[model samples]
Target chain A: MENREELKQLIARIKGGNTDQFGVIIERYQKLVAHVVFKMVTTEADREDVCQEVFVKVYQKLDSFRFQSKLSTWIATIAYNTSLNYLEKKRVPLLDDVAPQESPLERIAAEDNTPDETAEYKDLSALLIEEIDRLPVQYGTILALYHLEDMSYKEISQITRIPDGTVKSHIFRARKLLKDRLLAKYKQEDLCR
Target chain B: MSIKHLSDKRIQEYLDNKLRPESLSPDERKHLDSCQLCQGTMADYSHLYSGLAQEERQLLSPHFTARTMAIIRALEKPATAISRSSLFIAFVAVVTICGVVNYFINIKDILYAVEAFSLERLLSGSAFVSTMEQWSSRLGGNLNILVFAGLLLILVGLIDKLLVRQKANRAYFMSV
Candidate 1:
């Protein structure tokens, strides 16, 4: 059966008082939830705590889940809102500096052959993520949903509760801004070198 | 087809494949193909897209799954316990309702028996009537005491309910 169907079955069982079935559901979507949460929160610690809270809320409100969207989408929405709540509680500034840790591309560069592999696509990935991080929260969110998460506009609309037209507009603006920022970064890097 | 100005936003839409090729007028396509700036912009975006695709595959920390599972287990325990407790509370409520209904129905017969004994004494003689009169006056005094006691109990219950409601409101605000 499809993964969604399998998840629905597990959810049904969990709601029917079979708590053990929840373990399977958790195992299946854990990474997906963690990734989404990590994208929203600043620190690893906050991400961990919020991820736990999201699941707690999920279990507590499992009976109320209407299955209007896929389980993953619902979980992502929860993760997004939970991280936002965490930010609100901490009074952290929005659209702040990107996390100071090495970008994922940089981490990947550190793991393998350096000079030869670097020729493939030098600083593009890091530049793209930086530009995306600089975008407004709504724009950044839509870009993440579209490019990173591979969700359709309809799915993004459902998760974000935005109109499809707005989703399209945000994505359009996000990509334009990313393109400008990347080009500017490339020019600056060239000038620096 | 004449060359028309293409907005930067439209260039982005074209790069992301959000704009259908058929939707672009012939002049727009011609400009896209011939304009060096737009072409260069498209190449840069394409390269960025390809690089992002590769980076997207990097899995999160190895322990991510384990940590998430631990959380889910912890959360599920409390949730299951809560559901079970709510079910138990519902069961208790149903039993209490049944017990109350049963007592009201069964207790009526005992009440009638007591009334029958009182009526029999009244029908016997004048002495019984005088005794009943005294007893009734004593009962009237006791009933006054009981009515005052009942009002006091109701007042206490109302105060308790008000205090509980105040506490609940405070707790709710604090949680928010």
Candidate 2:
């Protein structure tokens, strides 16, 4: 609460045209912004670029902020919208509609002969990352927020502007799809053996 | 007991710990404990959970924070600078336009006085003709040149004003 008050004061200063105060806000929320952006964009390079764009937008629109939500929520919202705009500009297709069943896990498992080995686990982790990359933007986003960032469902709902139930459903479906893919990979590896 | 009857979704919920342990009916726990297939499925899910837990906390390179901050700073500097320049340019444009319009409106009164003086009739007709001819030969050419030059100056000023405006517009919208 004390921090929130300080943030509001800083935001007031920023909106009043002290742009250096805006830098303080950026310094504070940079990690949260980067994490959100990283989940949406594919490459490290793009994520870095997008994170900057998000902050730039936040800085430009500082005066318009009505203080209806938390500063972090506002920043995350900007991060989310900026990433979407970046994706749209890049002509990248949305991830939700296509239900590609083929899992990257299958490919990784096929390449490895050893089961339950650390190398196999590492390969599985890599496969998970690839599969996450392939997930629809919405699914990928929720998974990242929930699993990677350890955000609560309520927080995710706030960030996503989706209902909590909807967030849960998407997460459930995403996990099921991921599991099916991994299990199928394991079976295929067995057949090869 | 057909383990096949258990829904993938229900098993997932159990594995995720989303289901309240207190809310689970006795039959559900019994099935989970007794059924090898269900137990095996739970084990697989636990393994997957552990794997995800281990993998999710990936940190970027050590320089990632510095690099991201740098890019953000770069993007922000240009954006704010551009917006500030545009606001300044817009302020100048409004002032200039107001000044030009004021000048034209004030000059219109003087032009009206000149036209009214030119419309007066001659007092002596023959004398007037001679006078008119003299005026036309000497002052008329000079007047023509002066008026033409004045109009040209006004036109050039307006055009220059417009060009400045266009440059500001281009800089504001195009460069960034």
lDDT by residue (tens digit), candidate 1, B50-154:
655554534355665456555555443454544555566556555654554354434553354355457565576436555545544645444355446456655
- Tens digits of lDDT, candidate 2, A1-193: 2276787788788767666566667667776776677767776666766776677678768777777877777778888889888888877665654466545555555556565552353477886776666677778787777765567788789888899998898887777677767776666556555
The candidate scoring highest on TM-score is: 2
Where model 2 places Cα greater than 4 Å from the true spot, the runs are A1-3, A16-18, A43-45, A96-98, A101-121, A187-193, B1-5, B15-20, B53-176
Please tell me which predicted candidate would have the highest DockQ against the true structure.
1
CAPRI verdict on model 1?
Answer: acceptable
- Candidate 1 lDDT over A54-77, as tens digits, reads 776778788878877777788778
Tell how far residue A151 is off in model 2, in angstroms: 3.1
Clashes of 2: 1
TM-score of chain B of each: 0.39, 0.40
Candidate 2 lDDT by residue in tens digits, B60-112: 44554454445444544555555665666667656765565454435653454
